[model samples]
Target: MAGFLSSWPWENLGKYKYLLCGPVVAKVLYSRMEEGTFKEDWCFHISILFAVRVFHHLFWSSFSNMLFLMPDRRINHQGYDFKQIDKEWDWDNFLILQALIASMACCLFPTFLESIPLWSTKGLVTVMILHVAISEPLYYWVHRCLHRNKYLFTHHHSVKHCSPVLHPFTAANVTFLESLLVTAIIGIPILGSCVMGYGARSAIYGYVLVFDFLRCLGHCNVEIVPHQPFQTLPFLRYLISTPTYHELHHKEMDTNFCLFMPLYDAAWKTLNSKSWELHKKIRSSAGKEERVPVPDFVFLAHMVDISAAMHAPFVWRTYASFPYTMRVLALLGWPITFVITMMMWAWANTFLISCYNLRTKLFETWAVPRLGFQYFLPFAKEGINHHIEDAILRADQLGVKVISLAALNKNEALNGGGTLFVDKHRDLKVRVVHGNTLTAAVILHEIPTDVKEVFLTGATSKLGRAIALYLCRRRVRVLMLTLSTERFQKIQKEAPQDCQNYLVQVTKYQAARNCKTWIVGKWITPREQSWAPPGAHFHQFVVPPILPFRRDCTYGDLAAMRLPDDAQGLGSCEYTMDRGVVHACHAGGVVHLLEGWTHHEVGAIDVDRIDLVWNAAMKHGLKPVSSSVTEQQES
Candidate 1:
């Protein structure tokens, strides 16, 4: 019976589970339409209550994620996984159930149906008194019983305990039975005030707001309340629960069972002795002082487009846990993303997006407040560079060892492949790296060693030039496709005299029809791809990867590397890369920081260091995703 009651009746409805509240919503709307004006009625009040609760939960969830992005501010260093996120996805079902019960109560009781005043000081005081005299103790004992009773704990209360490291949504992540008990605790106080003839609409609103505020505060996983108040007046610690205090309860299940106050825990000898000390320590660590630790590495990245914005860790954790793909349902969020994009474009600056730990080293990802399309605008170049420059300077001031430029931030046209900053700020201590060395190495390693001839596009670009030079050094025949004879010969001349003949130049796609190995550094159309013969494989480094046109050919993903097994706290994917994998350039930055090399890796890549970087990466446990062109081959 307990197990049966634990599951919601509408649980199997999936996305349509919201229809459980449809009847109440329809009644409220119909009332408004028939009367043509708002009224102080049961349906109207219930609708408002539901909306307010929804807003409260959303506000805390978003606020908590904002704090989570800043590694120093997080109290619980353990990261949340997709399993926990999916488990808590239905946390708000309790709110809907509570509202439905309130509607049913209004129909059964005449006192609840009576018109009530919006505000009353006496009513507010009565609600607080009743809550202290009744709700707090009742909840304390009920919670204690749930924990002490074997059957109840296993069947009803254990679900909420699954997420030991709390997120804001964890507050209401309870079974139906436990939610009902919580509703009773909340309703008893308000109903007691009404029975005593001191109830007001304001009392109900105030009590619920305070209840949710403390619940969310306790589970936010960030120590927000300072230690000064407890120092100034020690008695205040008994009256309120801190995030650290609640976290201790989660960590040590047998202690700190109080709902919103430590007074009960104190009386029952359930308080953890280290709560106050741990709170002080966490607060001191996150303090804005000179002693705060700076990240060793920063991967400076930006959003690709409006659709990609939704994949941000803070925006939607579940969506970001996997490799990104275009979903039709994601179209619903475009309006909200558009408004945010406009705001970011107008006034935003560089900000931290996410972070993780690789052994003892701390790595972070920071975003420039710009999009993929914005990077190409004629007038936006200077502004984009300003943001990037500010981020680089800021990282330097904070003692950051290395900052890698991702995607368009390394555009040759924008900041000359990050060479502008390195040349302008010659005195800076932090190494500014384009990280294209490892990118070139990863691409070059993907080609089969036995291949004698290869066709290359975008042969004159930075990565393209490096790949061409490295491949030519091995005495392989290279068919470089470019219209510019000057730029083609410029790169050809850099190769050794023996290998210069191997770097052959071609002007049209038709020239590559006989070659089976195609390295695409530039986007090619279906028409251009049709020039390749059967069984040809396309290895690419282009953004927004080219379409797989031919059924006979296979296409490879962008250059990426899987992080070392020791990498920790990485719960979100990097753009379209698989879990625990990052773009090759991002891994290059990590390698640079771990190796403690003093030289800046900005501007043009050096052909000599291609094999050197690749060997170093393998030594550090970073594995290339594409080991060979044959591995990516598909039917």
Candidate 2:
């Protein structure tokens, strides 16, 4: 029976499992449509209860992520992986069942049908007393029993225990049987208050909210509550459970079995002795010496579009878990993201987006709260640079070894490929890297060694110029597509005298009609792509990759590389790249830190260092993605 009740009926429904709530939704709609029904109908109450609980859960989820951004406050240094995220994805299913039970109770009980007052002092007192006398003791004993009984532990309690590192969602990551027992434990206090004729709407709402809030707080994995409170009133440690206390339970089971209160654990002598000491240590580390460990490397990035903003970890965890792709449903979030974008423009600063560990080093990604289009706005340039500069300064102050500027943050027209800050703050100890040296390396290495000629677009840009010069030196004929003769000649002169003849100037796409190799640095229309001959492959560094017009021609993704096997705790994908893969620029920064290079890699790419950077990246176990020439056969 326990095994049968362990899993939810809709567990196999996948994303469509929300359809299970159709009946309650229809009930609410029916009640609203009936003109004779009161505004506060039972169905309306159920709907409101469900919505409020969901909102409460989301609040904790988001708030905990905010705390997670501050690494010093984290209790467990070890991070969670995608499997744990998948396991906890359906944590809210139990809430749906609870709502259905509420609807059933409202239908069956005549006493529950009576109009309840907003607030009742007697009801509040009764709930507190019942919770202390009934819920806590019952849960404590049942919880202990679940651990002691092999069958219960294996079939029921083990679900929650699977996640050693807890997140806010872990609070509800339990089997259906355990969820039912939890519901009953929570229901006793409220139902008891009603039986005593002291129940009120406020008491019900307040108790449920407090219960959920504490559960989430305990599992949040960050030690938020200070040790000062317990220091002043030592008994408070037994009255309220902290994140560190609960963490100890997950770490060393068979102890700290009390729910919300350690008082019961104390009475049973089940509380771990190190709980208080560990909590104090975490608090003291964050408070007294202020020893927040600095990240070894930082990849500073910005949003590409509204859809990209939705992929932020805090915004939508499930959406971010998979590789990002433009979807029709993503358009629905435009209004919400637009408002957030505007608000960020006015008030926000640089913030941590995600992080991971590679061997002994810690790497973090930080975001400037601006979208891609904003980088081109003339008025926004100063503000964007200011944010970028601030982030660089913060990284330097924190003793970061390498900080890489990504995407538009390294635009030549804006901050001169991060040169502005490096030149202005010459005394800065942190090495500022544009990381375009490896960007050019990744793009250059994608061209087949046998291909004698390649047509290039955005021919005069930073990456474009570097590729042109490098290819010319290889004696590979380059069709540089640009009308600016002076700019074309400038790049041509940078090559060795003998190879200068290989850099051919072209003004139109018609020149590349016969060339089977097309390097696209600029966005091209379908008309431009039509000029490419059949079987031509387009190697690109363009942001928001161009549309594939010809069926015969293949297009490559932006330059990226897969991290080494030693990389750990990478739970989310990087933009549209697959899991464990990162943009070439991000990989460049990691290689810079690992190589212990002290020079700031900003401004123009040194054609000399292109092979050096590529070789160094390979030496460090960073594998090029399939889009690179080395992996072309597999791709």
Candidate 3:
């Protein structure tokens, strides 16, 4: 048999070379795929499959690229990304490195466990329990060092930070060697478990896969858990870093360290000690950080952590450009974990489209000059749009008050006066407010004598139109404040017929963000609010009234502004906010409500202070927090 085999081994080898070869065969298969030589499935199904694959690649690839480049902020090919300025910044690098050094024992320690002489099954069980008890803590300490030390962070674990803005693919952004290194550190206990024969190899594999998946689950860029339980769960965080479990690692400095297991942290007190307090504090302040009303850094951080964790196991499910006979599912011998996969997919898809829209806003907005393919992507147009004429008609019909202010903003002040006042007046034909608008509008002395009631309806812009609609009611008398236009515009062509058309008189005047006129005065004879009589019962509310300042604002250091705010609002309130980050509704009469900043924690300031702040915001003119910020998917 040996002689016969020796003679024909070469023949067998040649015959099955195609099966045995590696990348070369893969390349050949890939080529056959493009040429249609494989004679695969029918054209339609294949086309659908290919399209899905291509889209998936692009989605994941771009997401990964953003996740990596955004966090590192090296100013490479993608230009400037703002994710670096998020809540915690990149804090995991240091922890993982420390884990690496200690992880060397991951391989060696297990050997020792295997070598331990054993006889009693009860003793073996005791030792296994001991191992479980000690294993996580050991891993915890190592993991903590990786996060806390800078040297370890830079050399060993820095890649994770590349995805400052974590995405699904970004989970595997770390060097493959580093992953192995991490596995090794944690593997020590796994090996010990196997060596002791307390748990079978299958158990070890389950532990490893499950553990790795948890680590990733914690790293997903999106938050998948509620703070209610995980929000309150302590000690266990270090044992197993859940979605929120890992996000804190990315948030504050030297705060949360436990990953995949929290017992060690509980014992050593290294777990996210400050997280609950900060979360509660912020939430109590606004009530909404917990409400999950808007997308914020916490949401982004959790998403990345989860995505990364889930990604580690499925490094490659489909063949790499090869038309292999069959594309194997990710799990090799293990039964399918469709539930887990579906859960990941469910969480992932929920926010994928939202993130895509957010990330691509610039392209869509800047492409207004181009029409080729950009038109198909409608992400940029994110809100209700109303024209100047239509707004006045709505005012006349809906009874919304229009309080047209008297002055042009700084931009228009640079231009000329008549153009600001009279020109828009002729265009709008509405009686504009004929008075001087002073800096201290909340003081109310700047108003003229005869005005009866002044409602700070929204601006003449699209967002303003929507805001005004929200404020106006059928029975109420409302004076519309806007850049005067000749015709009444409709909010929607098929808008419901307003009930009381008698009380509202729409007034258009060049207002904030688009004054187009220089210093406005009654003498200009062109565009004045014919509606805001000299003495009016009035109030002011800002448009997009979420943020405290503007995106391009430069008053002082603004904590590395989340520039081009995802959803921000700025205004010179009618008055001052007695306190910062509010909770209860303003006790004051006039308050500026930002578009997306719905809930804030209650503070000591009198509600009147909030009202004044809201008024001041309105005084500053109107601007949305994010012009492109529309309703988005969950963070």
Candidate 4:
């Protein structure tokens, strides 16, 4: 989605030339994937992985969804917000896992002569069975102790419960030391028994190998491993464990200890079907709490590299540990930054050469083309996205006229429902150049005549500064306005050009984010709600109180339209032929309107604190679209 190509004339015929760079991009990305888990060629791999996982589930076990609350894998009763220990009641099975790993390693390594080898198939099978026997009973007892003895807290069995809510990958995080101890205890005796040709048989060795892989597959954090590994054969049911069965064991630690079967837990009457219900409830709550704020991973990646670089340059040692993950990332990240930054520098240079004051207009317009929202582009830059997404939401909610102030290389003016195009004014005196089809969007919208002239080309905060200056000089009523860098720049620039003498007086007055709003606030921020200019009572036109809400505020209100009892049925008798501008207002703002023409929405302004108009001068520099500026500049 970030791979957006702007729809513009000059943007073509460049290094970013979309056609020729595919092979080069592919090679660079593929090479990075070979080095580590962070694969640059992830688009295809992730899709393949997802497909494999889904297929595994269809042919696998019988769980409806992976997030099914079960005792074994997840220990659903535990707190979902915090990590809980795994309850390995089936110690024998876990021991079997350790034994299998160690036995295979020992067999592979000849240097470990002191280690007895389950080198033969028969020997391997004998050792494996023995391991299953010894660990199984011990675990059953320990498992009982965990619940029966209050002294043994859950943490002791922590590793067992890791993926309380299991997917396929949850099987690997077992504690190393705990696994080692189990391996040593089970392995030595098995090897000793395998004296001479007493090592494990080939069949048994194969079983061990398959068993290890299945154990991991069964306890995965995802349900991609299929519902049942041994499908269509009841006899081979024990071959690959299902998440449902194993997950129950972890969660219901007091039960399911005997290996290769749930028969033990059932015969012993330790497993309860009702516990499944509790498991569901717990994980459900956890899923709710899973709403994590999206982190700025891009920024985080940069910091990691910068820190590693700083430390390495300071302390040099003879033996260098592997480069920090951050350092490696920095090396990769710098190239991307350089490529992007250099591209920006080039664009700025080229644009300046092509057009001077019009550069900003072209650049902005080139990003979001006029009326392009009619056919949604899924790929767009983050900045343009924020505006478009919000715009889309507003458009679909309440059809609107989206007037964009950009210089497209086409006809000077264009118009569409929910779309409008504004070019730099060739004749500044008119302030607005109405085309054959273009409706007055920005320059002609609900803004006052004098303010519209004042706000000509500025962006958001610049418009606000312009308004402040004009109001101060003309001694006009001022209302609320937004504060920020744009406001600062506009005041700095427009004040000298327009409001010089009253500059000192204007400097005494400042705009801030603290504005009061209970109206059309969906598109704005908290600061806009809070720091509104002092006394010009800032009330939000949260006019969109209902779902079909179009523009954060409705331009009209039904409550205000109720006619008085004396003025009933004017349509017939006398047809109280009245019509200039019918404005029905309440204490807050506009409620309804009946006139030859109606304006935007019902928003009350004290007219005391408001300035003349916004000076959007800083929009050229991407300063925020000030709240007032956003309100004022429609087209």
Candidate 5:
């Protein structure tokens, strides 16, 4: 899907070649059991075969159609503005028609393979060439005629032209007549070639794969084809059909009608000028070079290198630790208590350093820094709160619409599970968010549908309790770990009797037996790896994971957010704490800002609004990990 061959001409080949051609190459070596490479069953029915084909198309098309909703996996880097896909969900009738048309092709092609042999390399190549040779001119003329004819244009062809922008799914969005016409154009040529004894079964499949691949590519709106060859070697300009080339045909409505190859368009003098220029602009060795505008929900971040902060210089260490020692001495009535009190007063009365701008883009963020030791120090609470408030006020002054309090900032500001600070400061222009709703949502979404046996640590916490209830409702067996049996009983008693059967109460991690999926809440900070199950997939809610993942175990943080089309932008960029995107709590504030931008009531978002943030996150390239672990490598 990244790139193909290494040579100058072939290196430009994209996923189309791999997706369309690789299968043909594989099939040639090991022909299927039905192709007489193995025992043939006389009981095999053609209707069953046709039904299989229909179901195959239905399943794959449904899955591929949903891929548009995920930005990271998208073929095109440009994000879709309108949620046309949500509208496309009602296209069940169109899918049926598509399946019928594909099934009909299956019947004509390999099902009638008495005379035709399995396609060799030459046979497959010949079929593809003939298909392009025969179909292109006829398709061009017919398609142009449909556009020129007012009645047909308005009723049939215009259905496709209605979408000025094209997408992979958009290739299937055509009227019934248009779909039939396209199938006929493609089918007639390949079937004719097979009858002439120049084609094989492999060729038909290759043609089908190529047909879908090209249509999908033509509509992808992303111009992946390099312009260097066309620019340097002028004669090669007419050899290929680029995304920009087809897009021009959509925009202008009277040119570049050739499919796959641009030779016919050049001959007919219908090649678009704008497409040539666009190709030149994006013709670098790396393809696209432009930096997209930073998304509105940009993550505001700061470094929290625990190891570095803990080992600060002597003066800074003394500055941080002195207050705690003096407080202890004052409590104990140690000598020089008066002097210690005065020093403590001086420390408390010191002016705040204040948070300031660290990064800028669609949203700006002011970073607040503190040594890791400061969080545990006696003077830390007041200082941390002051910094958080300062950051919020600074963000508001700087015109930041929303500010997400990341990590301990959330802890200090919210006081470990209350919204009093944000609630009290209602008059501020900047909206503050903890971004936990979607974090919980992301974790819940990652739990597999087939998951039955589950282990949840810190089940007494808000997030753990919510997840336990959710899993119980799904009737999945849940092992809930808490500090005591009393809290476990409290949760168990809260559930309906019907759900009680699926709930297991425990006070220790070792009691969680045979559960493959482990949801470790913020409260359960297991220092040793053996505390978790062998080969377990750990979902850590904290930024720096509480448990060090075992060699066999997979781990991820709660910071999973996506960007547009997995575009080479902010989300994928390497950062200090984690290499990829920041935590969801950081991005959560961005999501809240985006919610407000869309005119939704936005403030401190709750778990109920997860869908809104989740949907918006995907649109902007927030990739959803199947499990709640944000820090796992995408395999």
Candidate 6:
């Protein structure tokens, strides 16, 4: 807990510096509104100022999106998927809607705070108190009613819910009616403040700006705010809504209806069920590398697109990039070109093309900020060369030395455990890693020493096979689960004689439920249907597993992996209290950074070199968080 506050590891100071733009632009508008400045029409002045506010809000929202850095879900769990709303139109629509609302408020509302007054301390305190007193119940019921009415929700309220994975712009995506209700709740209070002669324009603007920032933060996917205040003081949590508080609301929709304060939600018994556990995890994970800023490293990833057709971004970019004469010719010949391209691709494809920029930014985590850029590529199983080509170009664009392939990217690039892509892309200036080696290494490092036997799922898959071989070498008997008996037999025959017979095939996950350690290397269909034994550890390696793991079993994946004592094995990476050992894929990137290249063959998964890699991480300032998994893997 002490370590959480000892240092703040945010690295992307470039974005927050935009906050200054708000006030600077506001001052310019305020001067124009005064007697001697350009046209003393208060209405006109206020209208422009409203536009400025809308622009400022949009700027901040876009800035946050561009600097897509946040606490890794492995450290602090996140509810939103960053990739879902990456289209440029989504942002433009949000900004346009909010700007329209802001214009109305500035032009039509008679209660605009026009006069700047010296703040009296007592008056400020009174305003804060009155704000909650006036806004809470009004907002609470309005929010609840919006949800209760099917017509209102379907037509207006649901637009905001379109982004179940919340972002800053999500806070502004509400319908005009909902926005008006919010405005009225806020307006009446400021109108009263003016009637009492206590309204100071500076104080009002300050409060509004603060509210805007908090609202943006509440929707941010990252959870960095500490829950210590709620834990130590007890009453503070009810008063202030954390990002996780609102996130649970988006996730469940029935609970947590508070605007900024959680007081009403607490009193009404609408707080989320998982809020406490989630908050504890949030506060304790502050020191994770995801929360810190690593200047040199940036993670670029994409969700696996399983579609057969090439994504439209490539077509759009190609058409827009042509010279005027070529553009006209292409437009005239578009039907033929489209048909030819599709037919050729259907037969054989060579290059991957970009579909959209899902997230592009410098990420700030506990250690330092890394350049994090993510894009969507439609070529998941087909068009292998195109995918690899775009990856190289994107990495080069960011000047990143290494690029981590995620989901289908890993699947296609590695040929499901082969290094053909690396061999083919030998001329790429940057290193490409499948990121499976470190993940496998971390899972191997975390297995309990006392466990004599383990259950291995996805036994025929690339990752599963590697784990089976590694476990066999360690003399730990493995009960392997695979759909293909022939593949398992082939792997078994390759094992050392002493452990060859130790490997046994299991047909069902339920059959292996009693095994003490279950390594889920790939998704088994109808997953999470059979639960692991009560005390067993379930290590999940696949992303978006076929189904969520059963809740009762211990989550022994990277989110819970800890470091060894005294940071002996961790290299130069920074440590966190709750989340100790970072994800092995992340740690692998750090290892490459320290060594200046991919020392091992890229795209291959192995656990034999776990110690060397772990030591490399520790030497570079990485430390272990958990004392239990500290022992070196036995030879």
Question: Per-prediction count of colliding residue pairs?
Answer: 0, 0, 125, 85, 15, 37
Which rank order by lDDT, best down to worst? 2, 1, 6, 5, 3, 4
Please give, for residues 377-416, the per-residue lDDT of candidate 2 as tens digits: 9999999999999999999998899999998999999988
lDDT on C-alpha atoms for all candidate structures? 0.86, 0.87, 0.32, 0.31, 0.55, 0.55
Model 2 misplaced stretches (Cα beyond 4 Å): 1-4, 35-40, 67-71, 77-80, 110-112, 115-119, 284-289, 326-336, 627-635
Residue 450 miss distance in model 6 (angstroms):
0.5
Model number with the top TM-score: 2
What is the Cα-based lDDT of residue 21 in candidate 2?
A: 73
Model 3: CA > 4 A from native: 1-131, 147-149, 167-171, 199-201, 227-240, 278-352, 355-635
What lDDT does candidate 2 reach at residue 2? 56
How big is the RMSD of model 5?
20.8
RMSD of 3: 21.1
RMSD, one per candidate, in order: 3.6, 2.6, 21.1, 22.8, 20.8, 20.7
User: Per-residue error at 563 for model 4, in Å?
Assistant: 48
lDDT tens per residue, model 5, 218-265: 676655566677868877766667777777787788888877777777
Q: Please, what are the lDDT tens digits per residue for candidate 1 over residues 1-635?
A: 55757888778888797787888788788878888755656777788878988878777776666632445656766566556777898988888888889888877884554756778788899998888889999999999999999998999888888984698789899988889999999998888888887889889988988899999999988788998899899999899889999899888889989998899989999888988888888777774644245789999999898999888877767678888988886798889988988897777787777777897787888999888988999899999998999999999998999999998999999998999999999988889998999999899878887899999998999999999999989988889999999999999999998889999899999999999999999999999999999999999999989999999999988999999998876768999999989999999999999889999998899989988998899899998887473364331
Candidate 6 lDDT, tens digit per residue, 1-635?
22212111222343353343354345457667665574433444444555665655655543343323343432223222223343112332333333344445444653443443646555566568777897877788888887877767776577687764566667865554566566677666555676687776555556666667788778765665777777789888777777788778888888988888888877888878787678777667665654433334433333222121111122222222221123343465456555755565465422222111111222222100111112223433344535555545555454656655544445633254325656665666567665565566666667876678888877776667767888888888898987788989998987888879878898877777668688877665545436567776677676543454556656553422333333211111121213234455655665665566644335545556655666676666555433435554323
Ten contiguous residues with the weakest lDDT in model 6? 366-375
TM-score of each: 0.87, 0.93, 0.32, 0.33, 0.44, 0.44
lDDT digits (tens) for residues 123-223 of candidate 3: 44544464467655565666567667776666555656655444433444444345555556555654555555554433443444455455545544434
Q: Higher-lDDT candidate among 1 and 3?
A: 1
lDDT of 4 by residue, 1-635 (tens): 11112122223354343333244335446656776543333223323333443334322222322222222333322121112112221222333344335434544653543333324555665665655565444545555654565433333334456544553324433444434543454455345545544653343334444444455555543323332323445444333334455666676665655444443455577754643344344334343423211110000001112233222211211001222234453565466555544464344311100000111111001122212332233353333333433433332232222212221111112222113211222211111111111111111223333531121111222223333454445643333223344554545455435444343321211232232222222234434333333332222212222243223332212111122222211111000111111111210111111111122211112232222111111221211112343455553
User: Between 4 and 6, whose TM-score is larger?
Assistant: 6
